[model samples]
Every structure is written in structure tokens, then in C-alpha cells.
Target: METTLHHLHRPLGSTGLNVSPLGLGTVKLGRDQGVKYPNGFRIPDDSQARQLLALARGLGINLIDTAPAYGVSEQRLGPLLQGQRDHWVVVSKVGEEFIDGRSHFDFSPAHTRLSVERSLKRLKTDRIELVLVHSDGRDLEILQHSGVYEALAELKREGKILGYGLSGKTVEGGLLALEHGDCAMVTYNLNEQAERPVLDYAQAHGKGILVKKALASGHVCLKSDEDPVRLSFELLFGHPGVGAAIVGTINPQHLSDNVRTAAAVLSQQQ
Candidate 1:
């Protein structure tokens, strides 16, 4: 079987940004999972990370999602994508504090502005493609009162950010953001379709929907004995509301597998 994965392009909601159906997630790149791999798992060196990023680009994976809270993920991804920044879309989050050996949510306006500046420095980029408000499972009041959204709007206008979105842990948060946010990043999977209403609403309203935990945080993958992780990827891609799925993998073979799944889904759609 020739396993050269091909690209599948799609529109990213109403942003008019063309992206692949699948995107690279950099969460694990910043964390120490301590999980054993058959090929001896280890974090990729800078060169290795760059090589993988190149492979993703070649495979037509355009969006790369990262976060400051994800350990040193932003730092690792920044230099790797130095020159070819224009070829990919970068999405990051704010409204959270990661310092002093602890993590906490702080959506205050000052903290939000500080987060954007820090992310820009870490990304080594003059402008971010997308910046999302990282919600802390609180009521909508935090998002409204924190003034973070206003700051993000200002950044968008100043060209520091191309667009703004919200990442919420709950459907209510997603819904609120959809009604009031520019875009939404939500946890949507085959097992938990709670966000379906919000997804539909976003689609109808021309709001972008970037799906996270599409594989249920690896639960669906662990339960499967297949090549493509078919169920998880297919379920999300088949949904009309999902603009893109951000899946993570440090293994080259796993990356290839994800692209294969994306190609398969595109073929089925056609």
C-alpha cells in the first residue's frame, strides 16, 4: 500500500482562510508524558520538530495550534517556523497564567494584554493569525467583564492579530462565545456531541469552529485497532460545523496516519 498522504483543503469558517481539514497540535511537544513508545518516545529536537513541521506542510496541513500554558510549546514551535511563517496559520490562546510552578485562569484585561505580548515574543512573529480567549469554565460574565475581548479587538485592529476566538471547556461557554465571540474552539467528539447545537449555530451564523479533543483525548484511538483512527477523525470531519480538527502527534508514522485519515474523509466527501 502506497501511503503517501495527500492534502485536503477547506475554508476556515468565514475567515476566508484556506486550511487543511486536519491541523497539527503542539500540546505534547511541551509536556513530559512519560509514556513509553514502541520506537522509544522522546520529544523531538528542534531540527526534528522542524522536519516534522515541513512534512506537515508538504502534506497540506496548514494550521498549527499552540498555547503558552502548554509548557514550552510556543517556544519550540516559534523558531521552527521562522522563515515559512506565511505558509501556515498559527492559533494561540490567552487568559490563563502559567507561572510559579502552577497554572491558573485570569481573564483580567491587563493579564490578557500581557499574555498576547508574551505570546508574540515567544512566537517570534509580528502578527498572530488567530488569538482565542481561554475560558475557565466560568459564567459568561468573566468574558464580558474581563475586557479581554476588547483588548483582542484592539489587537485585531492594530494588525497584531488577524482574528480572535474563544476556547471554552463547556458548551455554554462555546454558545456564549458563538453568540458574542468572533470564533470558537470547543471540545467536540463523537462520544460527546453536546456542542452540536453550538456547532450548528456557528455554522448558520458564519462563525468559525475549530474542534479540539476530536479523538476524545486519545480514548477513541486507544479503543481502535486500525490504521487511520477512522472513527474519531471521520466523525469530526463529517460534521458540517467543524472548520478544522487540531490533532496532535510526535510520531512521524502517526502524523502520516492522520493525513491518511484526512485524505480518506475528503475522498468520501467528494
Candidate 2:
């Protein structure tokens, strides 16, 4: 007989970090102009954002993800997370900036440093727990020539970031990120599995793995009586290398449902 094990949270690779099975993404809390949700939504005000964060904590989510490409998400989080900073694992990204309703990329060493500094200021933190290179899909080129990876590693050495990884769009990029950094964020959903190799490498190497679009960004369609959300977690958490699935939602009810589904899958996993 095999001994069953239980875990309330999953480890982020070998980074010596553990996060809730569900990570709260703050994009919807700030940006709504170019979002791809099923329906339009009003950007939540500060009070509403705070309430969502509180609800997330109560539901056992410990990871919080935001990005500079997310319009005002970093700025909004700085003030809202004032006294509760120590209790969460915050993940932010560099290499992309959203301005004037558009996005632009810069991964030069100078810009990487500047970006991290700006992120620190905007997030009201001296150090970020994890930072990932916001990739531009040129996996091979970015991994080989971008110099952003080395810059982030230097920041980690200098204690500005605890760890750095790649939020990449290609398997090669994800593998290179794991080889050089601490983790890799991939899009693994019921509808897609192209990045399975990256997750396999993480599992083999004891490195971190974060899922970006576990539910296919709400593109999942149910057949018969299948629950897409539940199935997403069943496939996502079923993989031991997956640290957490980052889901961006401002609706409190939807957030609750996500957490509930993740918890159910984790229980089943044990």
C-alpha cells in the first residue's frame, strides 16, 4: 500500500518556496481596455480590489501576480497591500510596459535594471519574491542574446529579487529559463499542452513552474455536463511540477469558485 500525502500548498520548484494551488492575477483589477474576457467588465475600484485580495487570503491563496504590462495593477497593489505584505508571495514581471493603451518591450540590461527599480517603487516593496522575464516569443533569441536573464540573476545576487524566471511562450525559452534561472511560467490548459516538456524538465530538475492560462483564459467549453473549471484544476494540479495556476478575475464569486476547485483537486491529488 502507498502512503497518502497531503499538502495545503505546492512548492515552486526548488526555489524553497510554496504557494497556494491558485495564484491571484491582478490584471483584471487594473486593465480592461484590451482584455479578452468573454464579456466586458468594469475595472474594479480600490475598495473592490482590496475586498478581492482579502477574500483571496481567506480562501488560502498566498501567491499574488502582477505585471507592468497590466496598466495600473502594480500601482494599485502598492497602497492596497500596505500592512499585509509579509504574508504573500508576490510575482511580477519585467521586459514589457503598457502605456497609452499599448504595450512595448525592452530587455536591455539598463532597461531591466530600470524596470525592476520601477516595479519595486510601484509595488511599494524593497524586494520582490519572484520576477520573470516577460518574453516576446523569440525564445531562442531572447534566451541567448537578451542579457535580461543575466541582469535578473544579478539582481537576485544583490538581493533585489529572491528569484527570477521566464514567463515564456516557447518550450525552448522555458527550458533555457530553467537552465539559467529559478523557474518558468507556461500556458498549460485543457485545450493546450505544447509546454509539457517544460513542466517535465521542472519536475526532473526540482525547479519552479507556474501556469499562466490553465483554463485557457476562459476559452474552455464544456461538453455534456463537464465543468471546465473543475477539469482545469484536475489536469493542472495533477502535475506535480505545476506550482499554481494564475487566474485573473475581479469577481469575488468567481475567485471563490476557483479556489474551491483547486482545493478539491489538491485533496484528490493527495
Candidate 3:
């Protein structure tokens, strides 16, 4: 029912970044301590991870999403992606860190600067294509009180980050961040659509939009005969401003299925 979809490289708003319709989220690649995934699993070893990354790229995936909150994901990718850095759009986040099976947040300007530098190191690269404030759901408070956005902007000016934004939870916070940053990553799936307004604002303002949990974080279960994945993808792709949907899956077949479903959706849209 689905085919290839490489023609769907969309612009990530005005940041001048182009990304495939589906992005590979790397949360499962690192953290397993407090994951909410419907299924429990082991973290893939480097060789397995490398295989998955290569398979993703072969399937026309160019956007790889990670964060300091994802345990060793950033660090592992640094070495695994050796000799192939520029081929991918590397996106990392600050403010949230996964440590000792617990999560912590630090949005101070100093920590922000330090975090960006650490990411550059762990990523084994000199520059990060995009960095976002990994908001702790108090998106508005973080935007107003925290110096994180300011720090990322300075880094962008210094050529450390090409652009910065908020992986915010609230629509208002996302819109607020876009006033200062390049894009916003928010949740938008069949099960949750409250944040659709953020996507609307990003579309209208020419700011970028990345969809997280677009498949309901692997919990979008439906009847055996129902094509939930296809329906969910259609809802996301319906928004022309959605640069990509960040789906985390360790299964190569699942990744290919997502790509094919996107292609089918794109075909119908045409």
C-alpha cells in the first residue's frame, strides 16, 4: 500500500534547513530508565545502532533528533556517524539532561553555553545544525525567566548552532519562542491535537515546525485491521508547515514502513 518518498524533502521554515518528511528520534537509542514506551526493550549496541542509522539514511532519512536528555544517545552518535557528519541534519537540545536514571534541568546562561559545547564534543562535530531549549513543560516560565534562548542565540551568532528554538509543550510558549528562535518541536498525533495551534502559528509565521510523538510515542494502538499509523501520518502531513515527524524506532522495518506510509500519504495529497 506504500512506496518510496524521497521527494518529500521539505524546508524547515526560514532557517534554510531542509529535512525529510520523517525524522529519526534517538531517545530509545540511549535512555531506558524512565521510558514510557508501550514496550520495554534493550538499548541497541553501537554496531546495531550503526546499522539502524545506515538503514535510515538509505531510506531517505536525513533529520536525526537527539538531546542531552536521551542518556548516551548524543555520545554514541558522535562516533557512530564518523565520516558522515555533513550528510545529516543534527538536532540536539539543552536544559534537560538524563543522569543516573534521573532527569535534571538547567537553563542558566552559563549552563546553556556549557551544554552546547558539551554537545559539540559528544556529537564529535564542531557545529550543531540546530539546538533547542528542552523545556520542562513550564514552557512559558522557561522562556521568560531562563537565559537559555539568549545563550543559544549567542552561539548561533558565534557559529556554534545554526539555529535555536523551543521543544515546548504549550502553544503559547512555542509561539513565544518563535519570536526569538528558528523553530518549535511539539506533539501532534491522532491521540493528541491540542498543540495543533503551534503548528498553525509556525506555518503562518514562516517559522519551522517539527512534530514529536507523531505516532503517539508507539502507543497509538488500534484494532488489528485498522491502519493507525497511516491515519496518524496523514494527520501530520496534512499540515504543510510540518517539516518532519520525529519517530523513534529501533526496528529497521518500522522505519521503512513509516517512510512508505508517508509516501502513500503524499501520493493521496497530490
Candidate 4:
């Protein structure tokens, strides 16, 4: 399918960051935790991954989201975008640690600071466009923690991070972060409409809303005749507050199909 790139540029809240409506999720590109479903998805080599990244750029996808906990995702993505780094907006998360092949949450101020520095080295970027606190299901306590927020604010001052946000599963967790953070990547799929209230709040506050798992983590099985995948992308793109949507895929053809589907959906909406 011939893809038009215009459908990819979407406003990222009030931050003035123009990003693709469909973003590349790097969770699976890093490690396989045997979590099932999307978990255990193949991890692409640097060459193939870079080719995909370049394809995203060609299709006008400028926002790339990753987390330090995503195994070697940052390590792979950082160097891959070395030449075209400035052309894209890179986002990463903190508050999670990987030790002895295990993932753990540490939202303390010390850990937050350490995480940012480590992510910078891994991403090979002097300053990240956006940094989010990878909430480990502790939204309330983490928001109240002076150290974590203060550390992020400090990073903003030092120019290491342009802004910070939060990523969580629950609406309450996301709302709590928005009380102190600038952006949010939340799960707001068609089947899970409980997050509409949070989405409205974020829109009112001029905060960016990046939707994750827009396909309901593959729960909404697509129909062979109706193209359920395209419909899902349409639903996500039609959401008024959603600034971006992250869809995980390693197949080049699938990625191109996503871009094509997004173009057709957005065109219909417009």
C-alpha cells in the first residue's frame, strides 16, 4: 500500500511537540519475559531494528517511546538513531531497575536521579525530550514523594530532560501523576473506557495523552473480513484527547500496514 505521511503528525498536548499518531513501542524489542501474548515477541537485531526505525522516519513518525526496563531497547534504539536523532522526539522512563535478570521498582529520589543518568547513557542523548516515571503501581505514594518529583524538576533545570510524565495502568495512577507530571501514557483502549475521565482531565490541563495498548493488548480480535485492526486504529485516532498511540510490531510489512491504516483513518476523520 502506498503510504502518505501526513496522517502521522499529531499534536502532543499543549507541549507543541508534533508526533506521529502511531508510535513505535520498544517493550518487546528489548527482552522476552515470558509474559505471554505480546511478551516473548521477537527482539530484532540492530540492523533490522534500525531499518524499521528509518522506515518510521520516512513515514513521518517522530516520537519514539522506550523505557530503561525494556531490556536492551534503549541500548539498541539509542545507537540506531545516532545519525537522525535530532529529527525525532525520544521518550524514556525511570523508577524501574534491572538487576540479576529481574525487574524491580524503585521510585526513591536517589533511584530516579540515577535512572535518568543511566537512560541518557543508554539512549546516547544529552537530553531526552520527555521523561516519565514508570509507575510500579504506586501512584499516590510516588506523587507525594518529594524526592522523585524534585529530582525530575532538577533535571529540567539542568537541561537533561525537557519534561517529565507518567505511565500507568490505572486511571487513578495516571491522574495522580498528572498532578505533578507534564504528560501521561495510559491504557485507554476501546474495551477499557474507564480512562475517559482521566483523558478529559489531561486535555483540560494541556497535558499530553499518549495511549498505550490501543488494541486492547490483542484482546479485540480482528475480523478476517472487516479488518478489525484498522477499526481499532480508527477508534484510537478518533479519540479527541489522544495525542499519540503506541503499537508494537516487528514486521516491516505490518509496520507499513499500520501507517497505511492510520493514514486512511485520519483522512476519513478529517
Candidate topping lDDT: 3
TM-score of each: 0.91, 0.95, 0.97, 0.92
- Which stretches of model 2 miss by more than 4 angstroms? 1-7, 221-224
Question: What are the per-residue Cα lDDT tens digits for candidate 1 across 140-174?
Answer: 77676888888888888898988888888777777
TM-score of candidate 4 against the unseen true structure = 0.92
Per-residue lDDT of 96 in model 1: 64
Residue 34's lDDT within candidate 4 is: 37
Pairwise TM-score winner, candidates 1 and 3: 3
Mark the 10 consecutive residues where model 2 has the least summed lDDT.
1-10
Residues 1-270 of candidate 3 have per-residue lDDT tens digits of 335556778799999998888899999898889988888899998889999998888888899999999999999999988899988999999999888988999999999999999999999999999998999899999989887888888999999999999998998998898888899999999889998888888889999999998988788854435899998988999987788899999988898988888888987897
By lDDT, rank the candidates, best first.
3, 2, 4, 1
lDDT tens digits, residue span 1-270, model 2: 211112477678888888887889989977887777777889999889999999888888889999999989999999998999997899999998888888899999899999999999998999999999998888778778979988998999999999999999999899989998899999999889999999999999999999998878777843426899998888888888888899988888888878777777778778
Clashes of 4: 0
Q: Give the TM-score (vs. native) of candidate 3.
A: 0.97
> Whose TM-score is greatest here?
3
In lDDT terms, how accurate is model 3? Answer: 0.90
Give candidate 3's total backbone clashes: 0
Candidate 3 residue-wise lDDT at 54: 89
Predicted candidate 4 versus true structure: per-residue lDDT over 1-270, tens digit per residue: 578565558778776678888888877788777334533456788888988888887887788889888888888887887878898888899888665678789888788888899889988889998888887777767777646778898998899998888887677878877767778888876677777777888878888888888877666654346776787877777777788888777778877888888888887888
TM-score of 1: 0.91
